[model samples]
Target: MRVKDFIWLSGLLTVISLPLSAAENDWPVYGGDNLHQRHSKLTQINKSNVTGLIEAWEFDTGVNDTFQATPVVQDGVMYVSLPFNDVIALDAATGKQLWRYQHDLDKDYPICCGSANRGVAVSNGMVFTGTIDARLIALDAKTGKKRWDHRVIGENTGISEDASKLEDTELGSVSGTSGAGINMAPMIYQDTVIIGITGVGYGLHLDAVDSDSPLGTVVGIAGKYGRRGFMAGYDIHTGEQKWQFDTIKSENWEGNFVTKTADGVELPRNITNEKAALQENADAWRYGGASAWSTPVIDPYTGILHFGTGNPSPQMEGSSRPGDNLYSSSLLALDASSGDYRWHYQQVPHDLWGYDVASPPVLFDITIRGQPVPAIGQAGKTGWFYVHDRRNGNFLYKSEAFVPQKNMFSLPSAEGTIIYPGVMGGANWSPVSVDARRRLVFIPGIHWPVEYKLHQQAASEGKDAVRYSSMSPINTPEKHGLLTAIDLDSGKIVWQVKTENPLIGGVLSTASGLVFTGEGSGELMAFDADSGEKRWSGKTDAGVNAPPITYRIDGKQYIAVAVGGNRLFGFKTGQKIKVWRLP
Candidate 1:
């Protein structure tokens, strides 16, 4: 019974649990609340009228490719989740549409990065979503139909057995050989629902040859590919299964092999060939690959649940997945009802530079020393903005390097290296926004610097001779985008700005001082949440990447987003959704 007496009796059953909240004008869920705090208490549209806004409607969803969701809304409808998980309800004031459900994509499973989905979760009257082939479905929030589907992984679960001779090469045509699915965005918490599991740290991406343009080389390859990566809980009526957790730790997952970084940084390990290859990778947590990407930040006064975890499998080639991958690039914390394990902070233990805590964790409270605490911010892809201690994941400070870190943890080189926030991040799966009365925190970074390299391929004819690692973006530092705002009690950098295009997508903050974001060049912008100033922008035909939300109906105050673009950074897709108001 002692694991520090069950974490001090789970912090006294999380300080007498029962709060739940979320309705301050409704964006409903997925960063708007459950402490995701995408902030927006609705103050009409500030920064002096947000340039008089305009265009209060625009619904398309005709199925564009990487849109990346983030629409939610409630009582006034608006559900929105496309790029193939399909399910739209819209009408949050005239963007009409009412009911659509669709979904169906099994196409023999295997999905990774481009089937998008990121947005759903409305309570009891249903509307859940989490698909791209790992299933989960719910729908029926006033006629979108289908109530209950749940198949979160298990058809060929993790494929590999030479997955039909590696599906005929080029790493199975750029990773479609199965990375398992469910691109996050499913939260509920009372009768359960929660979600997770994403391309299980897969790898081998390679895209930009002008197929719209952005992510050109990812690679990874050093065998056993990927598998374990969980976070479950279902049964918001009958999808059944409850409580799952498992982001690789079937037994010490090699923890304590720490060569630094619980803040002290260092890590370029070898720890003597990883303790002489830890008994031949001791079952490598059965293909352990962490991938829960983002969408979890519960803490309703402490029932815990925070999220983040990605990169570990063969990703960036960490010697057959050796040690310190415990909860892969960690930030976990659970017990939202029963998934247990209460704390973890690990931002990049043995991560080999994919550095993924893929952004999404933002509770808030802060004060410290003068004592108020309960913290948990998190926008790192190794470019900082950490914060922690939401109960006991501890660390407590780190902000001020929104995007630009140069050789960070180093390692992969057969003559390449470079590194600045590589692996497409400095907040990838983007989602960060919390003004909690100006304690600030608004990040949306990604300066894109990669190179890395390491390759060696040979043995063809019948396959079997590889060892890889690749990452690309390093043409000489031109990529851009950052937006920061820090301050969380002086972890300082209270104003950052600089975006021409590398920002992924997500950030909203408001009470009306303002902070909205979007771009791959279709600009949605608006700033000055406290002097970052670029007050308003708006134009969009595509590439708003995804994430921007706000609500309120009869009394106006709109501003939604999800203009399709972002086919893994090439941007410019399009199926619209738009919204906006004031005028």
Candidate 2:
């Protein structure tokens, strides 16, 4: 925290706290009403009329870079975060730029392969966004004027004035560490805005061959190099700190050292070796790398918030940090007001592979054995859609793998080992859409494989002599995407449509029996929500690599998405937001 933030907090403590509120019909929340469903009830552009849907308007932000924001539509205006955490307000029907806020970034701001901001949150007459420099800013909804700015994370890692001169710069990706940044859109609940930090975990990234190829090799270095990650809530009115929940468990983080997952999936581990190493390294949890990157879903009735956690520290190699890393790679249930932990379900205990619970959790009601039960669903890097009891974090069942799964839990070898649904995941940070009325969930999937190989070497002549091992990737590979519809009751796939490139963005399903999503190939597509048939597509100048949103203004329905492509995933980059309607 900075001195200015402390002064702001001190002033906020003198004011009274009031509850926040949200708009029902507009796309105000990140996942549309805090359920994280990404589904809309508008039916103007139905299945029968979707074929005639055409471009209504387009706005280019003039920056040819990664744009992954989901526009927040309220009243008649659309608020979106452009590349580099910039913001713009446009007329929903005409795409006329009403206001634009140029984010002034620090010259030495810590960043990585690309600048990607998911979106923004609009609540209580204000628009809020988290920046790439790990700061949160609030703006007046009507005027786009800055209200208050606060540093969300500590500034120990990259605050030095002369940090650029270091070869392996502190908080730089080349040094096996990254600075805290807000890649997730803030979730504004009643009177409190919730947000999390990412890039706390260390992984090597290689250059992709082209725009259509899969991501380059992900190298996981084995050592202590990352800081702990957290999610916190702030006062919507005064910008005061409310409460925070740390992702990494500090005390008793090495829980039970369970050899298999709670559901009895066998994990490849040497328990004896892990138990022996635990005594010497009991404090490793202080630097665990369980970053909370995705936005959270809240049950408005009970105020119970549900979200997923990222991979454990020293990601791929787990020799130094022993025991089951509690809370990492799991689904968490917490009290929305107090930030108290209620329950957790770990997906991979002692995770040696980079399998994270990367997608946002979706809340819906499901019939269990003949009765209605509240359920939470999440798509994993492990290639399955896991359904659980929303209140208790109990696993109900897992759907059939959406993407192909091979050598899922295999150990990395001296000779390379092929692993399907690699670090990017069967669904990576992409929000799934659910039509509760139809009992169907729409998932965007990827089929990118990684060749995990281990490299062992002798100590070098100059540096510290620590016997370390690294996991590296093999070669450049081709990939594809899948749009899958699954039956919520049977946990089975109803239909799947394959695309040319891996689907790295998200899906949106509407009451009109239509599904809309984007691709790395620069195509914004619409499909028959029931049969998985392509109904319409509009080619763009760049990849449509962001979630599409739908809202109604003046009796007209419009679908909008950020067409600015993704750079890390080998997608052509640009800065364009395109909207469509029946023309």
Angstrom error of the Cα, residue 303, model 1: value is 36
lDDT of 2 by residue, 1-583 (tens): 7543342233322120111233335787788755677788788998788879888999988877878888998888899998788889999889999998889986586664257889999878889999888889999988899998888987636211211222231212223335678888998778999988887655544322321123444555555556677888999987778999998898988899887888778888898999999988787786677878889888765788888888887677787679888888889888888889999999988787777888899987676766556688999888999999886888999999999988888888877788887777789988889987677999999888777776554444454333222333333446788999999888899999999888988999887899999998899999999899998998998989999989888788888999888886768888888988887
- Give TM per candidate: 0.34, 0.91
- Candidate with top TM-score is 2
Query: Candidate 1: global Cα-lDDT?
Result: 0.78
Residue lDDT tens for model 1, 1-583:
6443443333533432212344677788888766777887778788877898989889887887778889889878888888878888978999888888887887866566567888888887888888878889887899988977978766545535332323334433453344577878888888888898876775655432532233566666655767888898888988887879889898989888889888888888988898788788787777778888788878765577889888777677778777897898788998988998988888888787778788788876666656455677888887888887788887878877887788888887878888888777788888888786777888888887888878666677877676676777765548888888888877878779888888888888787788899997798899888888897899988889788988887788898898887876777888888998987
RMSD of 1: 22.1
Give the TM-score (vs. native) of candidate 2. 0.91
Report how far off residue 111 is in candidate 2 (Å): 2.3
Q: In the order shown, what is each candidate's alpha-carbon RMSD? A: 22.1, 7.8
Provide the lowest-lDDT 10-residue window in model 2.
12-21
